[model samples]
Target chain A: MRARERILGRLRATALPHPPEPPEVASWYAGRQRNETRPQQIERLRSALEAARAEVHDARDAAWPAIVKGLAEAKGVRRLLAGSGSPDAARLAQALPAGIELVCFDRPIDDWRDELFDTIDAGLSRAKGAIAETGSLILWPDAHEPRTVSLVPPIHFVLVDVGTLHPDFHTAMQAGRWAENLPTNALLVSGPSKTADIQQTLAYGAHGPRELIVLLIDEEGAGK
Target chain B: MSQPINFHPVESFKERGRSVVNDPAQRKNFRSAMDFLQGKRRAQFPERQELEGLRDLASAIRRYSLAQLPTLLEQLERNLTANGIQVHWAENAEDANAIALDIARRVQARKIIKGKSMVSEEVDFNHRMQEAGIEALESDMGEYIVQLAGEAPSHIIMPAIHKTKQQIAQLFSEKVPGVPYSEDVDTLIQVGRQVLRRKFAEADIGLSGVNFAVAETGSLCLVENEGNGRMCTTVPKVHIAITGIEKVVAKLEHVPPLYSVLTRSATGQAVTTYFNIITRPRQPGEKDGPEEVHLILLDNGRTQAYADAQLRATLQCIRCGACMNHCPVYARIGGHAYGTTYPGPIGAIISPHLRGLDQTYPLAFASTLCGACTEVCPVRIPITELLVRLRNEAQARPDSEDATLRGSGAGRTKLATAVWRGWSLVYSRLGLYRMTSWSMSRGRALSPIDQGAWTRSRTPLVPAPKRLRDLLRKRRK
Candidate 1:
């Protein structure tokens, strides 16, 4: 353990008691001052939401059909779960074969059991907002929304309303402040749940859905 | 003899990528997993303006931190030492690896559990540890998958973006013999959780990557979705955090912006599921933690980049993987194709510099220069510009055909070559340029051919309506 001690010794030599100055923090808080007004901030938020929504819709429309086809080909996908606020989730569910089932939930439910939802082939939810920078979707836990609605199902279909997309991450947090009290649990998902734990080989859907289908919906385009 | 873990960077990358891409079932699994995450992220934050603000704040913080990195690192080092945490400096990959290996050997540690430190990946610490006969086990789910497959990560956030559930089922069936073949994700997670818990408890040393190293408090921050990192750090007798020198921020105040941005940029969460801040090992009154804490500050060519005025900006990267997620090239080919510890657009630029141009020349040519990576970079590293710079560097090699063709005095055989050379000569001398301009203006009456190769695929340049000299003369009249 001589090597450990030496490494530790070096560490000990470099340690100090407190952090550096507060300029960086002050600058950051100061920067927020420019867009401090609620109306101005809301307008910015609205535009950003519109842009994000449009992008999400475009991505979803391009990828959804292929995802649906792929899911249709899977072995055990009879019943699917869908959330409210999804643009085409209802329509898509209606379009499924007569024998298949679609269960819709308005919000998260604490009493929901994993096994009940686990048997389903897929779960569908509407994204509250999407971060374009990381391709992540944010989800909040609520009374009607069972946590397993997104996690237990092997296949997950997410509906992204084009109106609620953000280009970067900081904006997402700023929006979070608008919520009086944030939900107890929140999820930010980038890609399919995966692991490269075994000899550094990738395996998808390790503890969550194995398949992901994002449907970006442009409601205005329906009229077009 | 144990099979030699060959480190053929290129061939191995291709082989790994080919397997991942070819697996249709794996792709299905990835699609489903990403969909779930996307759904969750959306539900958490329904407003778009908030995310944008977070991004801006995050970018600003990273830029500020990078500007004062040298100072911040010194402060962090001092603070950490005062807190009874040992810190070491590694100038390069070899030094970093040697230092870590020496620590393991000193402890007579045969089993080491790692908790998702990407810096260790940069130095290929696992290979070094195995070479030294120390069993290195990855406790994180993603790292464990990579470890089991003998492959590297394809995505920084989700290392196994390319693998599917069926493939994992097959792998689990083979590796964990008693585990039944079940496509259920929960069952698989239970199995992994059980297996890793044992590994965590048994490991002699725990290694982790630092998310943020606060200079003010000498605290190392780790953010994770699972509690694995916490377990690995707290359960082991010794804890070692390996991180890049640039991870340091001057004070605790700089941390909020970074934390805000890192979470949103990484997964679009207001905050990660777990954010653990450890100031030092277990103190006198502390109940549980490692007996000793060690932090390794790895330069590994970062200082070289830091010294170069043009390259120093790159040190601002926070490893958020935003550029990778948005990059078209990375989306198609994945991370392994970059053939480096770091992958994606950032990797394309930084890897060659760190590994040497000769070893990583191909990576420089990997990008389409789409500029998307730069637009999304939390720290605004000018990734696309760096990629182009790397390309120019690659072209400068003596063996490059472009170099031979572009080099002076090569040949005047081709008409295009002669014209190019003549143009260059004329441009070099101001007197010659004036004469050429006069002649060109005089010859404007003659129609020029549209056959110039440069104009073939683009809009032909419009002849100057009139020379500046002509314009001046007309004005006098």
Candidate 2:
């Protein structure tokens, strides 16, 4: 407490120079967004995600679950993890074939840390929204869908509703009203985990998912 | 009132600089690495107008944050506390370490996993923890490599940038048990991933650095390409975040602009793999995330920078490391040669306040004043201008009445001071200047050929046959 007082006291004791008002950021990107159509935004996101080595599959709402199952099968995934009590998880379970085993993250991590880290072949979650400009998915981890569901697994499958896509990060934040109430953990994942740390050589799957498979649900056929 | 200086031998910087500059392999490593980075950054900012606009917004946001730093910090404390995240104040390196030590003691933590935190480096946290018989392990792939080799991070962003792949393969095989040597990057990364995964699961405490602490939302934002940061913060029971006090911003809306510029400037990424915004620890019903979260706000000489209005600009740095990558000096000599926790242009300005100017005076003079650092800074820090100011501060009279900087006039010498005074006297008087120039031109033949260090690399500094004024006069006629 004394340290806080001394530090703040020093800062308060000194008068800071008044800076000019910050520029309006909302309009700075306005010109770029003016001519871009919804389909164009989705296309931009697809190319950006593809460039980062993430696989993006455009599917209708009804066919999305089957796509995930097929992708899981193609990857030879045995035990796929899902968020317990989530509607998407329930839908996914109904769509999966009998050959694949479904694992629910029903309890606290302490109950099954080893299983999640070692045994889980893949994890599935729903992205709240996405940023088109950066090809990023926005996730807010909650009690139902814990943070590790998307992080720990070797492969991560995220379902994004194309309608929720924003033109950029600033637009996404404003549209979501994120500042009013934020979750314990909110994430913006641009690609599968990667690193260029070793001699500036690009390598994927550094610590997170090696493959990030995005199931883009285009209900309105915007990209058709 | 006294600022302790970490005095190195006077020629330590030059010696280190010479050694790195002369090594052909190391030079090739740095040259290729820097070229790759420069090209990527250039690609990210293809449109000069848009890049300038973003830079403007980013700089303004940083300035506004610094101006409101004191108030924002108080608000940050209140909100973080209200959010059930413990907040600790650290006035210096010792205070910061002691706080973490206290937390470790309470948690009875044996193993601590760490994300890449430069603040932890600033406080010597891992060393302090080791002294207390607790193991603090670095989980970032690059940091892990450097830690295994028992060395400080060579670069801020890429901690092991100084080392080549072959060297890392050698180090890993020797240090990591049961591992064979391999130069393949993917194979090596997998080895690191496997090793760190177990440590993350077993560690009792996790430590990370905060990129930006949003006061309004009581959140800590961390930007990283690897998932190590998430693992460190999530897998452990307790998560501890450390950051310099200057990292706070007043609102959450300010993050995007800064983050945009930071990623592009630092790594040429549109966005990193993960942008983690942590507001609290694990909630009651949460299945994962840390049970307890603690944030340490360390002042560590930042208050000194904040005390002066102009020096306050130093607080605007977002630690993107663009300045270092674009620096000619850093490219040739590398980060280690600077002999500071932060190296290159940013280090040259900030190290003086942290370690005192008396010992760090050489850093201010190491720059070529090329303005590349100033040009590339995401927040427009005016690095070269600050470098010039610090140089002046280091050479000012030691007892100057209003000396706010520590170790003022450490670089001042009687001979240099007298030389400057005489030069000023002669230049200010027209008759003396004319007489000196006339004699210098006439005595050109008498000029000494062996002119000391300046002549070592180039031709001797003999006076010209005709003065510049005489040449101009002849041109006019």
Candidate 3:
């Protein structure tokens, strides 16, 4: 017999009597955030992100490229990688400081995975939104901005607009209703790659980005 | 008396557990690791009411999922198929391993990089792959450490928790191509990174374990801190996800509470660094992600657990490792001592069903029924009650009236059954109770000093001078 039939058959044969209706789940937190105003949400998100060891910069709009450049310089990164066709990518390309090398995702990662894994010092991508409750960045990596742009590089740089912050993951998922139109992959990244495996010593950059630098776009003067 | 030391299939849990408890280093390691994890979980769920609400909600979600498991699994298969992904089913561990090996051979994969999958460990996947001459490397740092030491993961989340940092440093310095005897945490991580990076780039196939399989969207959710899961699923040409059938949920929203409690319970993190929601294989214009994605659902003995209403609670586990973290017996014995892929409280219950009760009698007996695991369980599995039930099942005769249970246990030694039976009979009779109490009190000095396994690590037990009934009667007089 086919494995599927046999397994499912056993499950059904041994199945216990269950209620006809599936039980209801508590979908929302009663008061996940004390205040839900745009600025307060941003403030809460920044602190939460910072607590997870992610560096959140208070610059947005036209100043994004300059802040990203400054971060790259601070990290001693010679090459900066980003996905193609995003407005953020265009702006970054235009304001490139002559010294650093910038590579955009035009070809398939299959063609350049080794180089991306080995030499790419930083990967900058745009965050679709931010979850304030857990301090996570929601990135719906698509054709233009592949998943590797946020994953492969040693330092992962994300562009987060303060207004896009949601009080918690549930609130964000509800508003997005991602089931209607979901990307191939959606990532909720709270911080840099880390491991507490060896004696709970807590080391960063085990297999992903060593550092996570967030360019928090405070378009609403939320910066304290 | 001459029994060769057998190790592979986890022979004799009592022997292994005794050795673990005897080692001061293992005891100290477990103490610090469990304390750190427990503290993180305590801090994560500070608000008592909120934490309870979440736990209740998580438990309800799991209950509802198990209730609708068959329908949801069918839905998941349909959705995944429609999303250009192949879904296969395995009836047992050998079947699952065979399917993987067949796929590997067909894909002509010489090198494979695997993310941390406890399920894979259950199937002994790496060994099977190596026997087929395929190099399957573990990408998770903890898993890699255990793999390097040629040992199984002692803890589920922190696989290398049994080993100290100095041991890890020595292993890395000796095993890794270019590394000194550096005890620095960062330097050690770098050494692992330098070695695993090449493997990730060169691997032909990526193997992962799904945390949650969303039936609503046919997406596989993987939660990780190291990002190796993402790499294993993205950098490779083909990605294979192996999961037990019970991992599916009805809707995407069901994930939030479960995910919330799972992270807080497992490692005390508010949320893991990365939560990858993979809906499909790479699209036509997509520049990254696996070209092919396959999810293999293994039933093994899970269906048997689901068949019985009382035993169905075993399927609700999300592999959070919270039960083990809080279990007093597990805290002292450690994961390796259990002699199974899963150790600790959850293991004590599930190992019987998965490995069969006859083979896992020692595992079932390796518990104190402390109820700490039940109290801390996010899904609120009545772990202590389950342990007691398993004990009864274990002691049951094969042809007994109660042996009708699908996963009903048998094979308790005749000696043990007689001892317990004799004690029970004597206690229930007033005549026997009085006679035995008087005799035991008078013969206290002549009590047996060697209490077998009980006295191995603990002081031997002897009767007190007076029984409660006798003392009360004397007071009344």
Maximum-TM-score candidate: 2
Off by over 4 Å in 2: B1-11, B442-446, B468-477
Task: Report the lDDT tens digits of candidate 2 across residue range B1-477.
Answer: 112112351449888888999999998888888888888899999999879888988988889888888989999999999999999999999999999999999989999999999999888888889989999999999999988888888789999999999999999999999999999999999999999989988999999999999999999999998899999999999999999999998888889988999999998988899999999999999999999999999998899999887888999999999998999999999988888888889999898888788878889888999999999998999899989998898779888854558887888899889999999999999999999999999998998888876786888888889999999999999
Give the per-residue lDDT digits (tens) of candidate 1, residues A1-224: 44334433433343332432334444445554554343333334334433322122233454564456445556457877765445555566656776667666553222233334344677766667766544566665343443346655667667666566654444664555522333323455554445434323344544455565666555445212
Off by over 4 Å in 3: A20-27, A30-33, A222-224, B1-11, B404-411, B424-446, B454-477
DockQ for each numbered candidate? 0.04, 0.81, 0.76
Question: Once superposed on the true structure, which residue ranges of model 1 sit more than 4 Å away at CA?
Answer: A1-224, B1-52, B397-477
Question: Candidate 3 deviates by what RMSD?
Answer: 2.8
Summing lDDT over every window of 10 consecutive residues in candidate 2 chain B, give the lowest-scoring window.
B1-10
Clashing pairs for model 3 are: A14-B307
Please rank every candidate by TM-score, starting with the best: 2, 3, 1
DockQ, 0 to 1 scale, candidate 2: 0.81
Q: Model 2, residue A73: what's the lDDT?
A: 98
The interface root mean square deviation of candidate 2 comes to 1.1
For residues A105-223, write the lDDT of model 3, one tens digit per residue: 88998788778887889999989999987889999998899999998889999998887888878777878998767788998999999989888988889899989998888765765
